[model samples]
Target: MRILAADIGGTNSRFAVFRVGPGPLEREGGLTLPSAGATDFISLLERVWAGLGAGPEDFDAAVLAVAGPVRGRTCHPPNISWGIDLERDWPGPTPCLLLNDFLAQAYACRTPAVAEARVIQPGTADPRGAMAVIGAGTGLGHCALLPLERGFTAVPSEGGHASFAFVGPEEGAYEEFLRKETGRPYAYGDLVVTGSGLSLLHRFHTGRDLTPIQVAAELRPDSPTLDWFARFYARACRNYALTVLATGGLYVSGGLAAKNPTVVDNDHFRAEFINSPAHAELLRNLPVLLNANENSGLYGAALFGQRALEHATGLEA
Candidate 1:
């Protein structure tokens, strides 16, 4: 099947055309364009189509993994731009599928071996139970996976916007500091674990304001601020694990976590991850995995396209 897939995130929008069969998808051509450079998503799609020498009606199916909520055919405003309505604004008359970026990542998880996904925590993943996926990139993205008798079902979540909870004195103080800086209420995950969140924590600890990239560049094992960030990050992961009963294990993907393996390897990270109030044992044993694949979102978009086509036609590929 010829599938056109796009993984749209805050920073970049990547589009690819591939042919898929019993084996992996073979890439025909792809392009990565900056989100800021495009006038709008439709213009971006036009550019992609032109660059590929293909028009809208050329593809059998199309899938888009967008960085925001999708309500029916319309998406909530993307964190980076005004909302994009895929069905209405798409370039072609072919069938298209829209999915939350994280949900697309979950579908890609079904074929974990295709990519070298690393296990950060080793806990039992009940393939039959609910599984959670959280990623911190341009923004935080979340989703859940439920196993059905036929296949796996994926659900997207806005849990990243949930109110922040402090599990330690440092976090509590950080919360107060954020309130003063932003002049708005902050969620723990929103303030401490995201790309901007890391910068916020760095400023709080060092009294030096820096962008997320700068903070990452300055991060060191001995730096007290980086240590604190690791603690809070692990705590947030543990909290998410417990809340979703992610016995199917927790999969952490995205640029933030993937680039900072030091945080995941630290003792503080593991300690915080297992620090459940009553059922510490349950939380402690749940496996945590890091998706090391760089093209996870792209692979996910392709999977979403394939799945949606199957559902529509009642034919399994």
Candidate 2:
């Protein structure tokens, strides 16, 4: 079956066509475009189809990984100005699904996206336990895969928007700085662990302004900004791991760790992740893996589409 797969984010929109059946998903065509370049979802989709030289009628089914909560067939992404209603937008009657970006990320965990993931912790994993997923891109995303008799179920989370914990006086100062900068009355993971988060962290520490890329370009393993970022990132991961009791494993996705693996592969991150007094032993025994594939979401969407296609075929049979 032919499938249309897309990963829509605040920064970019990626679209691809894949052939999936009894074998693995085979990519046909794909394209990526900056989200801000277009005014609305349909227009952006048009660009995608135009670039790929294919239309909705060309595919058997579609799965779109949206960067926000999906209510039924519609979504209002936080980072994007426009929203999506598949029923009104899609031109064909082929089965189409809208999945939360992180949900798709969870599905991608089983794909090749993490087949060769960089090991952050060599701790033993409980094969039957739950797995946690935390990734940082335009924003921080959280999800978990709960092992089940059938297989696994993806649990979506909006935890990133919740207030972040400040450890002490130093973090308190940084929290206050973030509060003032965002004018939101609190420091949240969405702003503290993403691209803009790097910019804010750099500005707070150096008393200078620079873009996220510039700050990232200057990141050294021993750099003070890198240290603070690593600590904050690790704290977020550790909290999520404990929240889900991720003994199966913790998989890190998104651009931050992919580009700067040292962010997760470092003493600072490891120390902070295992700092929990009550759960230190459990956390130490939990494995950690980081996926450097930035396009895993696309394949994930295709995998989801294939599942839906197979389910429909089963019902018909």
Instruction: Work out candidate 1's RMSD over C-alphas.
Output: 2.4
All-Cα superposition RMSD per candidate: 2.4, 1.9
Compare the candidates by lDDT and give the number of the best one: 2
Q: Give the clash count for each candidate.
A: 5, 0
| Model 1 regions more than 4 Å off | 112-114, 313-317
Error of 1 at 113 (Å): 6.7
Give TM-scores for every candidate, taking all chains together and pairing residue i with residue i: 0.92, 0.96
Q: What are the lDDT figures for the candidates, one per model?
A: 0.77, 0.88
- What does candidate 2's lDDT look like per residue over 1-317, in tens digits? 78889999999888888899898778887888999898988888788778988788888888889889888889999989999998788776667788899998989987876788988888988879999999998889999999999878889998889889988898899999998988987888998998899999999989889988889888888788999999999999999999999999899998888887877889999999999989999999888889998889998888888777878862122
User: In terms of TM-score, which candidate is strongest?
Assistant: 2
Cα lDDT tens digits, model 1, 130-219, are 787888878777888888888888889877777767756866787899899888766646556788888888888889989888888888
**Model 2: how far is 276 from its true place, Å?**
0.3
- Which stretch of 10 consecutive residues in model 2 shows the poorest summed lDDT? 308-317
Q: Candidate 2 — what's its lDDT?
A: 0.88
